[model samples]
Target: MANQSSRYPILCASFNQDNSGFAISTKDGFKIIDSNTGRLCYDRAVGAFIIVEMLYSSSLLAIVGAGEQPSLSPRRLCLFNTTTGAPLREMTFLTSILAVRLNRKRLVVVLQEKTYIYDSNSLSMLDTIDTVPNLKGLCAFSPSLEGCFLALPASTAKGAVLVYNVMELQLHCEIDAHRSPLAAIALSSNGKYIATASEQGTIIRVHLVSEATKSYSFRRGTCPSTIFSLSFAPSLQLPDILVATSSSGSVHIFSLGFETNQRTKMSGSFLGSILPYSVNDALDPAHHHVLHNAVSAGVRSYAVVRKVDKVADSSSSEIASCRSVLGCVLASELYLFIYFCVPFYLPYLYVRLPCPLPPFFYLLTSARS
Candidate 1:
């Protein structure tokens, strides 16, 4: 799921549950870097790795190897502590572990057809979910303890989703999202909303987790494109914005709050004529902002909305006094670009770091205010 077409030296990359820090796995070893200061927090020189997931800012890490060496098998998962530089525990599976997600309460390990849930503290097996064949391991997990829901593809034929409560260990609901199979999925910070994109990738839908129905739909493009990533702005209530990266090399920003507040007011205006809403509220083009050529076409890329800022603007009375400041990291074979953009305002490049080798994946830390 990290990269589809090109091969990068870095095997795997992932952020911690809260996105405060990220870990990268390379042929030589893996390293954890702080998202705030760009400091190297920890590094391990063992071998190549396929998955390296951190648990928040803690020293605990769940790592899977690339199967290059016998000790670092792809089917083996090691829970290692960075402070001691030694593994605390290990779990072997029948097949390769595709992905691992951790939070304060649960540990989720995903395989091609099965997903295992465990208690984080005691490491006791909690429950197991048998799912359809998921080669890419496409899923979304909300780390919030109150509404810690896990979303997985419900069907291989279409883009249906099954949302399960990880805390209560039961089924929540199912959402028939798209006719085509899903390409990417993401949950809101508080687990109130979930966003999905299908293989067609022409449209992205945002759904209410409780209702399990489409709440808002945004058009990605007229032509079919692959959605590399989808992220919701962190919020306890309804998130104001959602960000998406696509194979067409554009970073799309959808303003949900503005759309909601202005929908009634603009429905009878000229803006509504150009972008009319259907029964499902397919939003207008004005609300959809795109950053063109953010990454190389067809190269794997990921982006996240690290933070959103609200500022008072007396001159603008029709619009709300808020701005979505999106922090995105665009990576290709050569370098990683960390930049910020204010929708309807300006885009700014903060940091551009050249990679020692091709970076396979990268993630941004969330600063929830």
Candidate 2:
């Protein structure tokens, strides 16, 4: 049945750091699309490539034809100018490229059992590190232009995420995130937080890279579902807000807040004697808080979904049935709203959408800012 559905390998696609641009690759070809104007920045039906990624926040793109085409070997990687679709530089690898990630200063290429870091400009090799069997190509990069955080699997641990300082080439904190395979990994725009999900894709944990503290946890859904992506949106006034997209067709946004100054209390004094502080406060293992039955501020998440049914008309466009959702997460409460369409559009489509919705704190912001 699955073979009857798709004739070609599914196209690998991804968006840039700020969602301004996106890249898509299939055996048919490759193209970069602008998100704001809904236009193709560049299109190429040249090869049976399988991977396409944009250099963070830039128009530069990288494409890899690992195993999709045999005429071109699996090691060839091409960097192209998205504005003109001109090949800037091309390089070959010792093995197939499992995954490719780009920041402003560096490009990371992941193989099956090794990872390569390269200077984005010169495309020169910076360093190489061995890894455990990472078949899914699990990796993450901080969203900032000065991206220094790179999280990958540990070589010895079964399910540990090792954070590395790319510039210093030194090991940072390591989080024993899960015991099973990881479904997705994401780093905040400011590189202060890293969110991870296991293969179950139900529970997600956000950790402080410097302290390895589990600051926030989110349960995406009731039953197990495939997590499509996990992202940290930037905001000016928010603490930690994360967005997780899943195969369930819902975007789950989670916000986390902590008791301010708890860790930095000026040694409380009662009678000239100072209050006792725990020795393990810095790297204290967070009390395991699973998604189920966990308390959250205000509303947890709002989901936008397409109202389609088994008996729905096949000719109807899926976009015609999509409904947008709104949610607000306060310091102590979570509010969720699911409605039909926007105001003026109700006359045309009868949808109850928020025409100009108020800001819900800073669900999107750099952790550093």
Candidate 3:
């Protein structure tokens, strides 16, 4: 489909799990490229493609086409061999395919309000899921492909994240993440955690299913900024990182780790009041205040240490550096403003800085915002 130079062309894209290569689909065909060398690995003028995805095993690529009634139809879902431009499997369905996600174990196809999971090799239907109305066809496969997760709007409540375990066909948990519709959803590399952003895009909340704790909340900005993507930094080392890119032209990187200080703030008292203090942990005056902030904060990160844009503009023109504030307030009506709306400064300086910091030592600074 040669653009007559007037109409803009649209492309659908995705990267492989290992980040070795990426795949893109256009009206012309599907293409795969080596991410490292910028070399085209495979290209096929199969038909007009609407979506493309790669398997974690790097053995197959799945794509959805608009229609090739003569060769391939718009309803046909095709999986091709990555090494060779050979069609491995092709299936035609009745409805328009909204999205397709695959791992080493299974391939999931998303329809308007329904999802189907099939064996990658046999292409046999393993399970089918019913979603809320008008889901953006958003779903994710586990890191190991042992399970799957879907965040759908709650049938009863608006702006609720209905977490579903796609394998067992059960509801795992639900969180009232925001007042606005969800803009993006992400799963951690290990598949034990989930992160979500509201359509407003001012807040990011990470949910932990396996741990005793449930959620860690972070404020992305004072106002809404369109979030492009969120990802866990590839590492098996200390200080796990979660990076977020936005239309604001800033890349926010968060340094994450489990801290005993988080649990230091106790949940109980003589009258069961909302009082949090570091009783069990050492009370070094240096990291003392962080304990109060850690009562509800599970994932800890050093705040960005840059100038924040004070002028609220509908357009985000430049990038700003700001510290990642660590704060937690208990699940009570009294602390809602302190925990979620207001951003607190980091109590301690990150020993190893990931971003450039101000010349002044932030060690002794407090209440200076």
lDDT of 1: 0.78
Which wins on TM-score, candidate 2 or candidate 3? 2
C-alpha RMSD for every candidate = 4.7, 13.5, 13.9
Q: Each model's C-alpha lDDT?
A: 0.78, 0.58, 0.52
Write one digit per residue (lDDT tens) for candidate 3, span 162-252: 7666556677777776677766666665566676677677766666745413455556667686655565534343334454545554445
lDDT of model 2 at residue 171? 78
Evaluate model 3: give its TM-score: 0.64
TM-scores, in order shown? 0.87, 0.67, 0.64
lDDT for each residue of candidate 2 in 1-369, tens digit (9 for 90 to 100): 234214433356566766555665556776665543445677778766667888754668888884756744567778878677688988888988878888778888888898888888788898898878887788888746554788987743445798987777777878888776677788876788898988677777778887988765556655786666676655333334465655554556454422122334323434213433332222222221112211222222322211111122267633222112122211111111223211111222322233222122122211111
CA shift of 250, model 1, Å:
1.8
Model 1 per-residue lDDT tens digits across residues 1-369:
335423435577666665566776667888887765556788778899999988889989999999999999999999999999889999999999988888889999999999999999999999999999999988899999988999999999999999999999999999999999999999987898999999999999999998887778888888999998888777743337888888888888887876686678777787665675652256467567777776778766767766677655577645463465556554534235455555454443323344332343333222322
